[model samples]
Target: MARTTIGDEPRHADYSPCEHAVTPSGQPRDPQSACPGRTTRPVVCNQHGDTTEAHHF
Candidate 1:
């Protein structure tokens, strides 16, 4: 799988802000293992100055 930095623009065209999953390392989680009933909130990185969203499973 490809890895993205904190400020990196979304590589996937299907990027959705309403739902997402992130690991403890602050990386996007694998879709197959993601939780279905989880809700995500937007994430902001001060160092990279980028805005993103993440959820927990």
Candidate 2:
């Protein structure tokens, strides 16, 4: 898989956020993880990371 920086602008128009900060050793930290309190902001893209919606569950 392609790797991307945490805060850098995406190089591709079809880019998606990696969901979490990479490790110091340079590895994907988690599949569904992100910086703390990041989910509170408005979502610009729903292609990856967290989504903007609610469900009963």
Over 4 Å off, model 2: 1-7, 10-14, 31-57
- For candidate 1, the lDDT comes to 0.43
Across 1-57, the per-residue lDDT of candidate 2 in tens digits comes to: 554322232222224433555555434456465333222223333234333454222
What lDDT does the true structure give each of the candidates? 0.43, 0.37
How do the residues 1-57 of candidate 1 rate in per-residue lDDT, one tens digit apiece? 444344333322333442445665445577675434223343445453436444221
lDDT minimum window of 10 residues, candidate 2:
5-14
Please list the residue runs of candidate 1 whose C-alpha ends up more than 4 Å from where it truly belongs after superposition.
1-18, 31-57
Candidate 2's TM-score reads 0.21
User: How well does candidate 1 match the true structure, expressed as C-alpha RMSD?
Assistant: 13.6
Q: What would the TM-scores of all predictions be?
A: 0.20, 0.21
